[model samples]
Target: MSVFAGRYDGRCAIITGGASGLGKLVAARIVAEGGKVVLWDLNPEALAAAKDEVGATRTYALDVSDPAAVAAAAKDSADALGKVDILICSAGITGATVPVQEFPIDSWQRVIDINLNGLFYCNREVVPYLLANGYGRIVNVSSVAGKEGNPNASAYSASKAGVIGFTKSLGKELAGKGVIANALTPATFESPILEQLPQSQVDYMRSKIPMGRLGYVEESAAIIGFMASEECSFTTASTFDTSGGRTTY
Candidate 1:
C-alpha cells in the first residue's frame, strides 16, 4: 500500500524500461496510487510480465534507441492513456567495463545511442503531449557515474552525463509551462543492471559510497514518486541526488 494514497489520481504516465528494475518498481507504485501507466521496454517477454506484475494499462516492446520506434511508441502511449502527465525515462545500460583505450567502439555507440539519444527521442516525442495538456512531469534517470566519472566505464559515464545536460536544457525550455523536467542521479544501487558488471567493478562502486552500502530500489522509487506527482510543482531544471552521499552536489 502507498503511504500517499491518491497522490497520482487521474494521472497517466509512460515509463520507458518498465520491464524491470527501477522502472518496474516505479510502475507498481504509480498503479497503487491510482495512476494509469503505459510500460515500454525492449524486451517483449519482460514487458508482458511487467504489465501483469505492475498492473500497467498498456505495454510496448521497442528499442528506445530507434528514433522512429520511440516516436511511434509515444503516439501509441498517448492514445492508450488519453493524456501523458508523466514520463520517466529509465532505459539505460552499463556498457562493457573497460578502459577508454580498450573500449569496444560498438559498445560505446550502443551506450550513447540508448542512454543519451534514446532519451532525447522519447522526450522530444512526448513533450508535445505534455504541452497540449498544460501539465506534466519528466524524470530522466541519470547516474552518479556521470558526475564522478567512473573508471573503466567511460561510455556509461559519458552517456549519463549527456542525460544530465540534456535534462537541464529540456527543463529550462519547459519552465513556466506547467511541465517540469528533472534528472535523477543515483549512485551504485543494488539492481539487476549490476549483473552486467564484473565483481571487481561492483566492488569499486560500492567502495565509493560513504554509506558503505548500495541503495535500494524502493528508496529511489520514493523520490521519483514525488518528482512525478502534483506536489513537485515548483522544482524544474534540477538534479535530485540519490547517491548514498557519493555525490553531494
Candidate 2:
C-alpha cells in the first residue's frame, strides 16, 4: 500500500505534463519520497499551480513537441537539478474522437506530434544526461488503446502504440548500460484528461475493464513509482499493465 513512500530518495526526475492529471500525481508521489523533481509543462498557470502543489525542485514551461524547446529545457533542467536520473514522458493530448476517415488531418497530426513525437523529444534530449550519470529510469505512459485499438479513436491508439515501440527500442539500446526504459499501458483513470473525451467514448472504454470501474491516480502513480526506482531493476523495454485486467497479453 505504500510502495511510493520514500521509494525515490536521492533520485531526480523530469515529468512532462506535470502540471496536471497523472503527471502531477506522480510528481507528488516522488516528492513525498524525498526525490527531487523538475516539472515541464506547457501551461504557465498549471505549471505554477503544480510547482506550488507538488513542491518540485524546479519548473519549466516546455512544449515537448518542439525538439528545440525540449533540448533547451533539458539543458536548463539538468543545470538546475545537477543530474537527470528519471524521466516520465507524460505530456499528451487525446485529439478529436472520430473515425479515421472523419478524423481531421490536423487533429491527427497534432495527436501524433504531442503524444508520440513529443515523447521522442523528451527521451532523446534527456538520455544524454542519463547516460553521463550511468543511471536512470524512464517511464513512457502508453494506454490500453495502444494494445487494443479503440473504435473512433485512431489517433490516440496509434500514438500510444508508437510509445510502446519507442520504449522497446530505447530499452534495447540502453541495455547493459545503467539506464532502463519501459512503458505503462493504463486503462481509463480518473483524471482531468478524461474531460477531453466524449461521454460515449468514456463509457465504452470503462466498459472494457473487467473490474467495471476506472483506475485511480494513486494506483497509476504506484506502478510508476516502482518503475522509476532501483527496485524495478531487471525490467526494461517492457509494458506494465495498469488496466484493471483489461489487458491479458
Name the weakest run of 10 consecutive residues (lDDT summed) in model 2: 1-10
lDDT of 1: 0.94
Model 2: per-residue Cα lDDT over 127-238, one tens digit each? 9999999999999999999999999989999999999999999999999999999999999999998899999999999999999999998888889989999998999999
124: Cα error in model 2, Å: 0.3
lDDT of residue 197 for candidate 2: 93
- TM-score, model 2 to reference: 0.98
CA lDDT, every model vs. true structure: 0.94, 0.93
Q: Model 1: per-residue lDDT, tens digit, 9-77?
A: 999999999999999999999999989999999999999999989999999999999999899999989
Q: Give me the candidate number with maximum TM-score.
A: 1
Query: lDDT of model 2 at residue 237?
Result: 98
Cα error, residue 60 of model 1, in Å, equals 0.4
TM-score of each: 0.99, 0.98
Candidate 1, run of 10 with poorest lDDT = 1-10
Clash number for each model: 0, 0
